[model samples]
Target: MLVYVLAIDIGASSGRHILGTVENGHLALEEIYRFPNGAAMQNGMLCWDREALEGHILAGMKKCKELGKIPASVAVDTWGVDTVLVDHQGTPIFPMAAYRDRRTEQVTDKIDQRRLYALTGIAHQPFNTVYQLMATPADVLERTHRCLFAPDYFHYFLSGVMANEYTIASTSALLCAGKNAWSKEVLCMAGIPEHLFPEKCNMPGHILGDLKKEIADKVGFNCQVILPASHDTGSAYMAVPARDENAVYLSSGTWSLLGIETDTPVTDEAARAYGFTNEGAYGGKVRLLRNIMGLWMLQCVRHELDDRYSFAQMAKMAAESCYPHTVDVGSNRFLAPASMTEEVKAALREENKPLPKGEHDLFRCITQSLAVCYAQAIRDLEKLTKKTFTSLNIVGGGSNNAVLNQWTAKATGLPVYAGPAEGTALGNCIAQLIALGEIPDLPTARQMIRKDFDIQEYLP
Candidate 1:
């Protein structure tokens, strides 16, 4: 008998409900639903539309019922660092602020960066939950009851179980790097009450419960609500079918996360100086990674082009162009830029580099810059981990760009394995499969993925 599971993987810009099943010893994924997602300016601050997202979640579950495939378990994984504060009655206290919002800007400087890094092993990012909470108004914090990371909030909405999943909470810079628990020292520094977070941090693959009665009635069925590595990057990394221990995993999307898994967190001065973070991974492991401004520059550039070309067309033009100039793709100027195309031009102008002559030239410049950024990040990872990675696994939607894959392989001087574009969803389902007793363990699931998926290999 075949068992089915669902993974509702939500990213910064979009969300999808993917159905998963093992077919003849191979993992298969099918898209059940998809919806556009973005932060909109509300009351002079960028915020997520909670109503629309909740509605879509229900709609997707209803679609599953319409298709006659009721999953045995379901899970959700989303981007990290952004969460909502709920009152005692479980009502949202304020708008769900986007990580890109500038509210945390002033608060970040007040926090002791070195001490926080030593305690949590999270890099000093302005948008970290610690800074966000510090910037939040006193009245709002006073009324707050529980803080729910995006995925946890959605999980509670579906199951009426309010619990914090480990991986997503780790991204907040409030969780201890070495221990699988919240760091009270960090929380106190942010002026947030310790009780605002869940007392016990739950690991992924544990069952939250069946969907609430109303949801089950609306969707025509009930399924166990499970937790997958609730941070999308954590889930994405779980699906990497590494050939050996010496392979680096890159969860490439709007943001590019490049790093390796470790048994312990790296929190030394060198790691901190390199801007590396020690985030949580499945099975109590640590994901030591650097967050790069990834394909967002490309995405913004494409948007400025008024949707004139598909991603494939842009990649083809980029591969053919002879533009040799490159800029720092990880620079802060590119983050939330008013005009990405103009930002690229301005970055080049400041550096006294030649500017792109056309849209294709712009594409070439952006891709080249990103590849170089990836290469440098890999070098830094090697330095921090003291292990030389032989291969790089590129996953998520960004893996589909063949030109970028080739450039990455060339830039990193390592073999690149790219595919399983729905990596986050795949990892989310893998946890459910294990919980449902359909798959034995993560290693076995990875082996199945390697045999089943069309993983394209590019040589340097």
Candidate 2:
């Protein structure tokens, strides 16, 4: 028998409700609803329209009704950190701050970067929920019973339950690396209210509650609400369909999450110093990886230029351009810039290189530079893990840019397997499979993935 699940996966730019159905041991996904998401100014503060997002979630749940019968489970996963402050009534206390917002300024410097890394075993990302929460007003901090991540907040809405799942919580600085509870050391040092976060729970996949009677009647789904990996990357990591131990996974999209699977946490000094994070995996494994700024550079530039050209057109333009890579793109300045095209050129002019002649040249530069950065990160991973990776699985919307994938393979000298772009959703269904016992664990889920899906392999 097959079961259906709805995966609500959120990114910085957008959120989607994807329907996943598993039948006769094969899993498939369909995007049922999607909504635009981004940061906005609220009373002089950059805040996420979290209310609008929850509206999207409810709207999506309604969409599931159009398909007849409710799904067996509904799960959500989102980008790391940046949570909402909810009162005991489960209402948001304040506007959820955008992760990119400068609100963390008050807490950023106070944090001893090395000590923070040592304690949490998480890479130092500027937008971590802990730092952002620490920067919140003191008054709201006093009234909060439990802070919930974007996903958990929605789960609470749908299931009328409250709990923090492992993967998303790992992104917060509060979780102790090897322990399940909030770390007093981190809370004390960061001056965070311990009660701000929900009590940590065991793992993600389980029944949260029956769909509320109103939602159940409206959606016609009386099924249990299961928490599939509540972190999209954790869900996406579930789709790394590598057959051998020598393979590495790249959950490539807005962020290029490149890493190898491990049975245990890689908590060495080098791993910490290099900014590698030990995120949770589906089957009691650690996803030892680094988050590289991915196609966001290109997307921001395209948005800045008023979305004048399709990304596919840009990829074609990149492939047509003739250039040996010209500038150092790994600098932090390239991460977030007002104008990516201008930044690329300015970085080139600084190195005394010829300015890229036109759009094709500019496109080629970012694609190639991104490929080089991927190669560099892969090299760093190889150095840290002392394991040679044989293939790279490129998933998500970024996989459509074939030019970059070819360059990535060329630069890294590894075969690239691209597609199954709906990685997060696929991973979400796999987790349901785990919960239902159709799949024993992550590796077996990945084996089933290899059996069911078609992946395009690019050779160097």
Candidate 3:
């Protein structure tokens, strides 16, 4: 008997509801619904439209029923760091701040960075929940009763349960370095009340509860609402089909998280200085990775082009174009630049490097520079882990860029296997299968994925 699961994977730009099933001892995915997602500028601040997302979620589930496929369970996985605050009655106190918002810029300076890192082992990012909470007004904090990360909030809405999942909590820079709980010292230093967060953090794959009656009726199904790593990158990493432990995993999408999984968190000074973060992964593993500004550069450039060119067109042009000039694509200046193309030009002019003559040239420059960044990050990972990785596994949407994949393989002198673009959704479904006892364990699931998906390999 085949068991079906629904995996709702949400990224920075879009979200999709993928129906998954284990057929003939292999995984199969069918995307049923997709919707655009983005931050909206409102009241002088950028915020997520929670109600809009919730409506889309319901619509997707209803479509599943229409197709006569009521899943045994459903799970949601979303980008990390951003969260929502609720009052005693479980009502949102304020709009959810987008992680890219500038409100938290000064909050980091107020806290002791070294001490905070010592306690949490999370690299300092202006948009982390710790700094976001610190940026909140005193009155707002006084009224807050609970804090739920983005995915947790959606789960709460579906199941009427309020709890934080460990994987996503680790991204907040509020959780302890090596523990599964929040860091009280870091909370106190950031002026955030411990009581505002969930009383206990639940591990990935913990069943929250059955879907609330109204939600179930609306969707025409009553299935378990499970947590699937909660953090999209965590889910993406889980889908990496590494035959051996000596491979670096890159969850490439709007942001690129390149690193390796470890049994222990790396909290030493060298790791910290290199900006490596130790995030929680499935089965209590730590994702010791560095966050790189990824395809957002291309996405921004596409936007600047007024959506005149498709990504495939850009990639094809990039493959044929020749541009020797390169700029550091991971610079913070590109974070929320008003015009990405302008920003690239500015960086090139500042460096006294020749600027790209055409759009294809610009695209080539971005891809080549990102490959350079990947090469450097791979070397850094080797130093931090004290083990040389023999291969690199690129997963998620950005992996489909054949040009970038070949460039990365050539630049790093390591074999690159890029595929399983739906990694986040697949991993989310895998967690649901594990919870349902359909899959034995993560290692076995990875083996199944290796046989199930189409992975293209590029040799150095």
Candidate 4:
């Protein structure tokens, strides 16, 4: 029998449905649909285009049905920290906030950082759900009965099930990263009522149920709707094709996450001072990493410019252009700059730095600065984990950036291996495979991946 799995993997920038099949001990991925996703400002706050994205996922599923292939199971994994609120009847109560909203700017300072660090062991970022919910007004939070993170929301749409997964829930400062439940102490201190969150936090792959009868007839599939490491990074880590014990991972995309897996959370002040987070990863491991300002800078600039040039063309020009110096791409100005190009130029002027004169120079500056951040994060991970990584693996869309890959090698002084550009989908499918008892654990499943794909090696 042919086992087909439909994985709906959506990121902040785009969404895709990948078909994964296991044949002769090898894993194969086939793309069926891809679509764009973004946020919009509504009534003075940034919010995700929920309706459009929801439609995108369904359309993808309907496409799979048209091909007459019943996917074994369907699962969703999206960016962490952002969630939607629903009333008792499971109807959305308020618009979902974009995780990049600036309302959380001062909340981090107001919270007792010491107590927070002790509880969650995750860094205080302005966009964290903890900060966002704290910023959420009394009326909005009060009227809400259920909180649904991105993936769980999709699961509800598919199986009529409602539950929160551990990984995504951990991203919200609401949970104790070490203990695995809502941090009541932190919630009380933050003045956030305990009932605002799910009463129980379920582990990944919780069998919500089979797709509802209407959905099954609407789209034929015998599989159940499962949660695959609800955090996209968790799903990606499940598919990390590392062959050595000392390999580190870079799940690069809208945000460049550089980290290593650890058995326990790093709660000491050293890890906090270093700006590393103890985020959730596969098998309940702590991901000690720093999230870098990534392609958002370039993407924002492109959006503002209205697609004057293609990405490949820009990269070619960026590679050809040379500059006297680089700008601080990590600057808060680049975090959510009103104008990326203008901000890049302004920062260079402020620092008495040489600014890029052309598009190529600008693109080169962003890529080089991002690679340096990746290199620094790798160093930080090594220091936090007390392990020397043998190889550097890059996955996700940013892995396709050849110039950035080579520069990451030169900057980190480590062997850089890149590929599996569709990691999120691979992770999603693997979870469905597990849900159906097609495979055992992550290691054996990853062995199947190694047999399936060819990864590129770049040594410094």
Candidate 1 regions off by >4 Å? none
lDDT of 2 by residue, 1-460 (tens): 4567788888888889888876776777788899898888899888888778877888888888887736777888888787777788878888888777776766788888777777777888777877887788788889887888777777787777887777788888778764566778889888888777646655867778887787677666666777777778888878878767887788877788888777777777899877788877665567788887778878877887799989998899989999765555556566666688888889888888888888888888888888998888889988998888888887777877788989999999999998678888788777876786666777777777777877888889
Clashing pairs in 1: none
Instruction: Name the runs in model 4 displaced over 4 angstroms.
Output: 220-222
lDDT of 4 at 135: 88
- State, as a TM-score between 0 and 1, how close model 3 is to the true structure: 0.99
RMSD of each: 0.9, 1.9, 0.9, 1.5
Cα displacement (Å) at residue 24, model 1: 2.7
Q: How far is candidate 4 from the true structure (C-alpha RMSD, Å)?
A: 1.5
Q: Which portions of model 3 miss their true places by more than 4 Å?
A: none
TM-score (all chains, Cα) for each model = 0.99, 0.95, 0.99, 0.96
Backbone clashes in model 1: 0
For residues 180-200, write the lDDT of model 3, one tens digit per residue. 888888888878887887576
- What is the per-residue lDDT of model 1 for residues 1-460, given as tens digits with 9 covering 90 to 100? 7789999998888999999998788898999999999999999988999889999899999888999999998999999999989999999989999999988877787877988999999988888999888888988988999999999999999999899999999999999985778888888778888778767789989899999999999999999999999999999999999999999999999999999999999898899999899999999899999999998988888888897889899999998899999999878888898999999999999999989999889999999998999999999988877889899999999999999999999999999999789999999999999988889999999999898889999999
